[model samples]
Target: MTDTTVLEQTQLPIGDWEFPRLEPRGYVEPRNRILKRTGYYGGPVKGAPSTSRQVEVLNQGILESPMQFEGLLSGVETLSKTPSVNDQFQAYALGLVDSPNVVEAGDVGVGKSTLMKCDYVLRALTLLRRRVVVVDKKQQSPTEPWGEYTNVAHTAGVDPIRLALGDRDGSRINMLDPALSQTRFIAGDTGALMVLQQAAALLNDGTPLDTWERKALRAALRDGAAQARARGRVVNIYDVLDHCGVISDELTRQMSPTALERMHEAGLTLRFILERLPEEMPGLFDGETSENVKLGEKLTVFDISQLPEDGPAVPLAMMLANAWTLGTIRRSEPGWKTTFCVDEGWFLVGGPMGKVIQSNAKLSRALGLSNVVNIHHISDIPADDPAVAFIKEAGTMHLFRQSKADDAVAAAQIAGLKPGAAEQLMTLPKGQHFKKVGLAAEVRIAHFRSELERQITDTSAGLTGAAL
Candidate 1:
């Protein structure tokens, strides 16, 4: 009682105190000192809130704009909700791409072939109503003995033009066929002559023809064409082979003694090479293009899977088929678009053959054609090769997983991707790729497929035992 009375006398008055008194342990305030309020209440509010303060207000300009890839190719599983939709024609029309050319590079079993089959071939035909021609090199399987696209072509109600060495029933495409020469696509006789020279070079182990060799080859081709026209038939490789070593008096008159000797030697060497080509690659480029090798269908598959991988047959077949397809397209009426898909594109884009592919790519837009090249990796192609220029000129590129560090870096560099993209490319999962269209920034895309497409585009028949 004495302590409580002394404390109470020492406490200051509430109104006179500068600060609230500190309470002791177990202290309780009087009921009248405690503040109380009823349920819910608001202070007097003034004017309406400003638009900037409203939750619904948004800056439309700052919002991310959607990508305008018009054509529906696949679903995009990136940050954006837009589907991964684009084809060469639509991208070109939308001004999103400069050239109607596409390239796909990645490691094997990473879905390059599937994309080619689905997007470039099947979807191209069904969705866009465009024509597709596939230079199929991969064998269907160990038991099928046909191209991987054999079933795809059959699904489209057409048969693949199969080319096998020494098989009399196999299809043939004369590198010297006059149909290629007649169409001014790559330009008349000059185009045919180029094919011949390229074939000779391929036979010569990728060494281009020298001045003398070129002169000899040109003269022989001219003579062969004239002879074929006189005979009222198309010129074949055999016609050119017959005139290879024959030096006319005009050719002899134009050359000095030493030059004449060199030209003669060149002619003989070229003849020897051309002569041995049929023996080496029997049934190919030996006769006129087979009657069955027609582009009557919306899709045409030149099955060159039977050719030896390490030899010149693959490249020769690709070159001839490309030339033939271009000539046919040039002659066809306008408004219809075509896509030429070449798998194992390294074979077509190396050495002299690369120049032909490059020329075709340059003329892609004018001819209403799209060139789709599928290769293993950019690192596999030589840095100095002409294919490098063709690859760099592509308006669209699909980069899949590159297991090798160098390959990933090369893919990034070739596609002009930003920093850290190489690392992403190295780790990209199967069916996922980085798509770079024209000058736009590369976007990470996860390719989606339909159930029907999955069955038709499956290339793992050997592994999974799935029927196409």
Candidate 2:
């Protein structure tokens, strides 16, 4: 049997050609190693990407010393099918990026949706050398398909996998290893999965949080909780989950009667979460769900666009569980390299995600996970301090085009420049973005679109679908 894992890492047998020296990634080097861990936000620190920026050859460059070498250039012929081209697969074989995490920042319509394009990620897959896992939101429809591959690109080495939210437990996703089943599952209609997961854990561990942690979580779970308390007004479910994370109106319809009944029987109809994540939150595919969150050194994109406007409730649950399970990698299992990336990361931030990122960022490295998060804007995130800290620790950042005024302002403020430092922000063209690393010169990235856009419908699967 062709080992899909091995297949994912194989390189395109296309050349004796020299790869341009990776331009000095410079200061971001420390953070660059962030995504090397086996999974989730439990690693040293840093990160990777997609698009035209993912171009394989220099479309144009001054071959400094245009012919300092004469015979070095022959009538260039592609290295057709030799094991030599697989050199790039070493990292995967060596277990470099077992699970990868990431967070992207940009306003709506500016390609935040476009960021996870498969083409670039597939190119990156060649280097990381690991299986791919996709966690898109739970929706009524299937994910945008990405089927079909040019016989050429396939041989060139584009390996990947895709999974949808509606999947039953133990269902095999296209690119992910079937063995890579979720350890736990968290479920909720509201975006309070994090709170519930933590609440569940805190209860299990029998550890109560201090006042500050409670305050942070309350604020995170509900948008109007503080104001309600301040004004002596009533705070309800609508205020916390719905209004805050833009909770789903549809969730009301989808709420399972059996689960609700079970919850009531358990004497817990709802859960409230605050700061400290649980020791662990496990998942069950039979449908009794908990937040099934896991991290490893593989590129994991949790796309929430399909969810109701409320954002992702599951991540909170996963974060809570992770806070319990993987948090002890230091005492538990050392020498693991990992990176965690959260796409459209609003829900997790400030609520459960913010707490996890905050508690783990500085220390995760030794345990083998580096954390990277993507947000549409600074305001979308809940924590003032942690949000800024995450941006800084990310080492390398990409600023995609955004249409939001306030979010744009927040992005600039977090960047820590004068009032107008983000002036270029307004002028950014579609699919064009800005990039920065720890003290590295801020650069621009022109997202290279995957031809997959065309195959986003039926008949197209992995390399083709475009989720809108």
Candidate 3:
């Protein structure tokens, strides 16, 4: 039947409303109509007309994801608007870094020391309740006659353990003190022998002892320690010096007549070096470790600022201080963490002392210690030096502004920064630094300090003539 006939017959009325009559048309298959309808809507839609355009196009590229850091330290604002907040220990605890050791490098007056004093030392003590041991090398001022951290140490309820050259009343640290050998890191005679070798190296203008000299020094240390124990006393450098020339039965079995003569001469030389130490730098390393050099408080500052910059006195004191601190920490019960900070760290990480620091850094985690080394420039240290290895071993780095382009490049390279980070290091303003935590992308951080912190952390008082 036709569509019109069908529609007319099916139409019905209800309450005077009848269905409209259907229009008659040629019949086509349903597939053809469906395909035609699909083609019309499948075409692309038109763009907005030119006259309807109202806003300018934003063609700038997209930004990267913001970085995030979390910890219990002071907050630092980042360029990406996220807070970069974590100390070395905190970062290590979070697995963001593999080692808790940190190296802070920058030029002078760029806030490296200030950040260390405030964020690492102060905050760690007050907030985390961690102990800190600082080998402070900078003087308070030319006229102040004390280390820069003297006031900070006092604030932490402890006096700075002052060491001075030719000052008879200054504190003393026995190079052969029994406590140095009492630590878990270096047991019995091993620790005392290491200290003696370091002392000999420092005294000889950074030249290490030859095999004969090492043998002589080791034999003397062993004999001296044994005699001191017998005498019911702890050994000192003087005791070791007295026993250096005493050839024992063990020496005869160890070497021929000619070798024995060379060994004896080497022992005399080491003895001479030790004998002259008291006259050269009096009251240091000549007696037992001072009663005042106790790590009884949360903060201990070894004020070695008065020692001459050109001599071995500074590094010698630092070495002893480090040994004493490690021995104390090792003997203490586990679960108590400590932060070991060395400002002007170049002194602590050069010559034979570098080996000591490297060893300590390797065992820092086992001892619950976070080692922090603050230096002015990595360029100052030769690339082949052992200290360079120690610097590289630090998993976290805070790089501040560097005055020289070479220095900036050296620091950036050591920190494994990207190509442009070296330029960033040169132009970074004061209080802003590039912080690289482990293998994560480095962040540009602006370190913020409150007024109280500013007052306490100020190292510019010497230059600015400001009150401490």
Candidate 4:
């Protein structure tokens, strides 16, 4: 038989099937198919205008004015409206930010850092009437975003105080200051002991003090506080060490010989750690706090920009700054909103002070405090580290452009993002991020900063030749 005749005999007979009726001979439609000729089974109609989503979102309502809360809005702060990524139709309206904690993660140049700094810091200082403390490590030169923002802060009556190492005339924070110690001294001896424990923890980099070390340090701090009280002087670290250097005979007799021996050894080790820290890290924390170190109606920048990035001083400074800020806030009148922001917070959260920052984060709301923490990558944080819990507990998260697949995955998991978010992270253009507030669906935000804000927060001023 001829080839053409054979093919025609084997193929199914031609039929007029077009458009909606077009289907293969054996094709079958499943009963559970989501898309139908009319519309999606559970969603909007097929080929509906882009305005549909906008109408749906707006129908839910725009943010209520902060005035609605009146008395309860005491520490509530208002931020610029969060705009939707694209204006194909209408933008989704975001409410004023009142969350106790905000965590942001992204790769470099993705704009997450600038967004939080300009938005949160500006709102906190101006609108919220809150004292702000920022541990800034990114201002490498005079034109950097933080540096320019400092100028803006200065003009706004919020003088920016830069505390850098070796700047003797600049701000200083004495971790061993007696007044600072007294803040930790709660109920007399109990409080005094706690202060000593903190000192031990600080010196040991947050590892728990050993039993013998604890006993010895507590005894010494207890005794030193008494002596300082008698002399009308503040008890400093040296005094505690001095007390340890000579364990009183009466106290020594009370302990078993082995316990006494343990105390003696622990005292020496503690002394070595404290004494060596000053020698190793000189101008940062070795003296009385600078007289200029005041948190008065201004933004206090713990300008550790001069310190080496990988050195131990950064984390230590963060710990001291956190302690100092907490104490200052507690001493202030109640109902004042205060925001504590840590930029490049890996130093604070991924270091020995992680536990300190974590505990402070938990007590933030009760204390009328707001903690804003930023890091480059979620995967950089160890899974079991205390910081993981801190990141997870945050009420708001801004997930910016992630450069690595693993980082995107970790960010998604930590933020409890939708499964598709992992893939979205890979393709997100710069300056756009996925923001999730509490259990709400993630919103795509195209952050809009004013010209003034741009001038104050442009990190690429040098490369772009942008003027302040």
TM-scores, in order shown? 0.78, 0.44, 0.79, 0.71
Number of the top TM-score candidate = 3
Runs in model 2 deviating more than 4 A are 1-103, 118-121, 128-135, 138-316, 320-337, 380-385, 404-406, 416-421, 453-468
Model 4 earns a TM-score of 0.71
Please estimate how well model 2 matches the true structure, expressed as its whole-model Cα lDDT: 0.39
Residue-wise lDDT of candidate 2 within 1-468, one digit each (tens)?
A: 221221222332222122212243223323223444545436456544556776746576532221112111111111222111111122223343232223467765565544443322334444433323333332313453322222212443423222224534322111111122221222221323343434434343434444333433343344545544666644433334333223234533655767434333332212233211111221212121222333343444333333233323355334433433333232223333444434445655555456567565655443444455557667765556466666655544556655667766767665543456377676676555554433434444444333444233112232334433
Estimate, for each residue in 239-336, the C-alpha lDDT of model 1 and write its tens digit: 88889878789978887988778887988988988886778887877877888877536888999888888878877887778777877787676788
Model 4, residue 431: C-alpha shift (Å): 2.4
List model 4 lDDT by residue over 31-124, tens digit each: 3333454455455555556777677866765663322221111111112232232110011113333346778899887886676666667644
Select the stronger candidate by TM-score from 2 and 3.
3
The parts of candidate 3 lying over 4 Å away from their true place are 1-69, 127-129, 248-263, 348-350
The residue ranges of model 4 lying beyond 4 angstroms of the native Cα positions read 1-99, 142-149, 152-165, 176-196, 205-207, 226-231, 252-262, 295-298, 461-468
Ranking by TM-score: 3, 1, 4, 2
TM-score, structure 3 vs. true = 0.79
- Output candidate 2 Cα RMSD: 21.0
Q: Which candidate comes out best when scored by lDDT?
A: 1
Q: Write the per-residue lDDT of candidate 3 for residues 236-290, one digit (tens) a residue.
A: 8777887887899987897899988888898888887777677798888787788
Q: How close is candidate 1 to the true structure, as a TM-score?
A: 0.78
Whichever of 3 and 4 has more lDDT, that candidate is 3
